[model samples]
Target: MGQQEKVATSLAGAVSERVSASLTPVDEELERRYPGDPGTRQPVHTVYVPGEQFAADTIRSWGDRALAALDEHAPDAASFAAVLGLADDLAEPVYTRVRAKLEREPIEDLRVDFEDGYGGRTDADEDTHAARAARLIAETYAHGAAGNTAPYLGIRMKCMEAAVRDRGIRTLDVFLSGLMEAGGLPDGLVLTLPKVTYPQQVTAMVRLLEEFERARGLAPGRIGFEIQIETSQSILAADGTATVARMIDAAEGRATGLHYGTFDYSACLGVSAAYQASDHPAADHAKAIMQVAAAGTGVRVSDGSTNVLPVGPTAKVHDAWRLHYGLTRRALARAYYQGWDMHPGHIPTRYAAVFAFYREGFEQAAARLAAYANRTTGDIADEPATAKALAGYLLRGLDCGALDTAEVTRLTGLTLAGLQTYAGPRRGDLTPSAK
Candidate 1:
């Protein structure tokens, strides 16, 4: 045999000898330690409203309100026009298109909040409100309002603190009980557990959910929750170990996401109220930590919101839109695909910023992706890691309706099916250039 063939034969023989002599068996526990696959659908943003204000038609009304605000402030989409640097004449047409999209898919997720948005009420009033909110959700589901509501719908319970733990649990129990009684639970129903500072809290919440499933005769683990990383303790425990990872571990495979809370997290960090914003350095650091801890653990991380809401007279509304758009763009740059919207006015800027971000980079990303797929280097060389990132970007863009499948396919020379299948890391059975 040739010298190269002899070297290959020698290496194979050595590996075979090592494998035959090894006494250790494969560890099943280690094999199952990694997290399972993440959810297929992650909403672009979640709209939070007071529990008392929630109803089956709330999302549709929110869209209508947003459309009216868009017309009043920008008069045929002037706000987006300014942001996109389009001419005045194009504003109306652009506004029309955006308005249609808003009317069709008003919100991707909606959270009826009992924490921050729902202020402290008398005990009787709180209980009454909880029951009312539960009935609203039930009626919404019963009357087919689920079709109009966002794909992901749930409520944000009060934090699991000593003072409010019972209240929180009661609200969750009532809301869930009502929904279950209304025929069945809605698909993609999630509970938002705020102010998560310890792993034990996650464990307790999981146990409660298990009890809920048992009592309701629902499928086990049907209810999952998203943990809010709103406090300093949630970043690092007293012992200095990462608390986010611990929380995920404590969740026992039911933690769907980690959502940042801007004001509360900043307040806990001793940040001044004047500077407690989503893009604050301290907030960014916390989010970065969350990203690291949740990476590959199937826990999606979301950025916080801009409380400088768009309200009041025309000029103030314009200013608020500008600020919201800038902050949203910043969040998008930091890879926070999801955020919280406090008001209907924020919707226009949200869609505008997201669409613009995806549109601005489409061509270059497509070119590079195409080059990588075809095994040909383009203007900028594409590595496997960069290719995977490009593919993910396109996929997210498609998911959020920012980029169409045909456009992506035309630009990247890969059909939608092919892009979905072969856009990421290459498998042993699939060739990189085949798609």
Candidate 2:
């Protein structure tokens, strides 16, 4: 071989050996433990409600309420069509579709918040609210609200600060106990411990959950929790190193997700209230830190909400839609597939933005994926990364009900059988259409 080629080969061999020598048993164990990606259903957005207002039928009626708001504010389908930039002719059908989907399955994740939303009630009042929340959970399960509510339902306890830690624990204890006694824990039940500031808080929460499980006679680790990365301390250590890794490690496999609290996190960074938004650079930085720290650790990361909220007089309604749509689209672009939705008026734009984001790239992604699957050389080259992305895109579409198996198969030249084989069994019926 030429001298240059020989030198290149020698350098490659040296690098490979160095990499091999750097491997340790702990690294191998970590790989084995994490294994594949965490199997979790990521909802598009979570709806936050005050604990006092939470009830079994609250989520059930959200869709109708949202639709009514749309009708009153926008007046006609054409108004929403204008917001979405769709052709006038497609407006009514699109409106009908969005409304139907919302009615059939409105909220994807619901957070009954005791922190900010519920505010600081008196000790007796807080206890009363907790009991009411527990009873609501039981009634919801008995009334089949679990089936109708978002697939992931949980409560957000107050931050585990020194002054409020005991209060938070008490609320959780009372609520869980009441719910369990009334009926039973429903499927997809989780707890959200918010404004996490330290790794010890996470470990402590896990231990508390374990104790509760044992007391309730439930299986160990049956309860999972999510940590809210709100304050500045949660994302970065005093020494400037990322702290999310330590937080996840402390959870010991019960940390299902890491959620951003836009306003609180931004405020913690000293950003003025006017600038604390989901799309603000400060918020983006926090989310990036979270994504980096949680990468491949099976911890789903979510963005914060658009607090501008699509609620005002009729004259100001369009402006509200514009703001909400812009924020939602920005979150989706940043790869934060899930975010927070505060107002029912934000519902129409939420689904529209997600559907449009996926639909915009559908044709090209499908064609390239089909070419990759068929092993055909085409104008659009498919790399391993691109293939994975294409599969994920289609999977997200399917999961959100934006695309059906028949449509996916017809566009990609892949049958359901092929998708199942290629993507694995957990994909459910996300296969290509049967020929």
Residues 1-435 of candidate 2: C-alpha lDDT, one tens digit per residue: 555543334366688777877887768867744644453456788889998888778786788778887788765778787865766555665576567667767787788889999987898988888888788766665665432556667689987899889999999998889888887787757688998988999999999999999999999988888899999998888988788878988898888889999888988889998898888888888899998878777778888887776667865777887888788888888888898899888888888777767776778888888899889999877787678668777767666656677888899988655654455335542222111
User: Which 10-residue window of candidate 2 scores lowest in summed lDDT?
Assistant: 426-435
Error (Å) of candidate 1 at residue 344 is: 0.8
Model 1 lDDT at residue 333 = 95
Candidate with top lDDT is 1
What CA root-mean-square deviation does each model show from the true structure? 4.9, 4.8
Q: What local distance difference test score does each model get?
A: 0.79, 0.78
Rate residue 425 of model 1 by lDDT.
Answer: 35
> What are the clash counts of all predictions, listed in order?
0, 1
lDDT of 1 by residue, 1-435 (tens): 555543334366778768755733444433343543353557779999888777668888988889888878886566568754644654554465467657777787888889989988776777777677667666655564422656677899988889999999988988888777766687758789999999999999999999999998888878899999999999989999999989988998788899999999999989999999998899989999998888767678888898887889988888898888888888899888899998999998888777667777888898889988999955788777788678777877776666777888899999766666654332122111111
Q: What is the model-wide C-alpha lDDT for candidate 1?
A: 0.79
Clashing pairs in 2: 416-432
